[model samples]
Target chain A: MSQGEPGIELDTSLGYMLKAAASALHSAMEAVLSPLGMTITHYSCLELLAQRPGLSNSELARGAFVTRQSMNVLLQSLERQGLVIRPARAPVGRALPTELTDLGRRQLEVASAAVRRVEQNMLADLDTDEQDQMRRLLRTCITSITEPPASTT
Target chain B: MSQGEPGIELDTSLGYMLKAAASALHSAMEAVLSPLGMTITHYSCLELLAQRPGLSNSELARGAFVTRQSMNVLLQSLERQGLVIRPARAPVGRALPTELTDLGRRQLEVASAAVRRVEQNMLADLDTDEQDQMRRLLRTCITSITEPPASTT
Candidate 1:
């Protein structure tokens, strides 16, 4: 029972449920991905490159939902590991476009398959219509929160 | 455009959409809570105690979706700040049931209102029926991922 003021009705709060669902998914991903020595952000960067081929560090940071500083550190590590490549000097401006190396692509194959299985399991109970509905609803929530609040100033 | 194998369909993947929604909500909450000098988990721990008083550190960790060691450190910090209390020694077992102080309750009032606003913003576009649908869909996802990988030899 909620005692008094300052109480969030966690049982019915959609945000709370969203967090719970995300936390569960995170745990499941870690369970599989950790064995590969890859973090969610690591796999995310590789996946972004696999799709986009020449994403900038800022772009990858945005896609991975991490800070640019952290993304830079990861990019450097990945580069040192021969999993990704970037020109020593920016081809244009100060942005160095990054792409996955062949080694990175090969590594992604195994990790990506493992991740796909987790996603599949997460949707195992939802039918086609339900899954589509979920995507639409989740996008709505994302937009609603991410949008700038109506000018109260 | 997706290059080839190992690339996740970012636009259509329900899992990706879920992460996007959760990330937006997280940013919104942090925007508000940080000004209140609380992290999401810090607010979450106090909120949990507000709703369910006398929860052990481990129980709080599970509810907050953090490791017990991390929760223990947070609990110690909260105790030092006079926001929460635990017996010097366990009243029964190794578990220390945690309770909020009056100061904690006061602190939660401000943070809880901010969090509620964020949650409401996230659901602003959804009517009651659609909100319920999102809840049901998310719960299904949580269960699917959290349950064991159906008895592989």
Candidate 2:
């Protein structure tokens, strides 16, 4: 369909492509991780906490690119599963720092393998170079989109 | 951290990058489309139905990459909103076809503009060639990941 005029019709826009690829990968990951009683969001939260122990709730929310409210809900779910523990002492103006417990660590280990297997299948078609390129480009785009705008005088 | 090495290291993996980009875009699109009272899932269903006017329920599910069960739920919501209509007669073995109403078409027009604006802002940093390359690479990867494997001897 034309936008009020005739054109080549770029149906494969970057947004469409990104959404399609992500959706496909996400669906596959969900299928693989669901039996473990986790969603991609759940696995991501564990992955973040595993990598950065003692991150405040807000910090974790920022890293996860979700609203603080949403992150809190996820934290509650994780805490219930014994995958994470929040400290008693609260930060000055933020929620208390949270860390993974031994049980959480073990769960992370299992989840990591499941996730890596899914990633391998997803990237199987691409050789090393293409995979690297894909990662680099996506990283650049993510950074660009997430960055604050520069001052325009 | 090396493989099998533990404790809080940057993931810096392709899966992480892909997931982050997708999450960011999803959040951005959600914010933009929220004023219209539509989720990305809703917008996607409407778009597919718009392009293919007479799609059956299962076909719509496949086109939208959602399970039939989920599609049924979404269809119910859309039906409640009066944006979609389904015929009463059930064909031989197939469910009745679904199509968008006039209100759905108008809503889609508005949503399309909002989507395009957000997409433009998201891709502002990349040049045309880079955009093309990103789309091509993502398309290739998705096709590879979603395709059925060839039979092995």
TM-score of chain A of each: 0.92, 0.82
lDDT by candidate, in order shown:
0.89, 0.76
> What CA RMSD would candidate 2 show?
5.1
Q: Tell me the spans in candidate 2 whose CA falls farther than 4 Å from its real position.
A: A1-11, A147-153, B1-11, B148-153
Q: Which stretches of candidate 1 lie over 4 Å from their true place?
A: A1-8, A151-153, B1-4, B151-153
Q: In TM-score terms, which candidate is top?
A: 1
lDDT by residue for model 1 (B1-153), tens: 565555578888777788888898999999999988999999999999999898899988988999999999999999999999999998876988899999999999999988888888888899999999998999899999989979422
TM-score for candidate 1, residues paired by index: 0.95
For model 2, what TM-score does chain A reach?
Answer: 0.82
| Tens-place lDDT digits, model 2, residues A62-147 | 77767888888999888988889997668666568888889988988887787776677777778888877777788777876676
Clashing pairs in 1: none
Which lDDT value does model 2 have at B33? 89
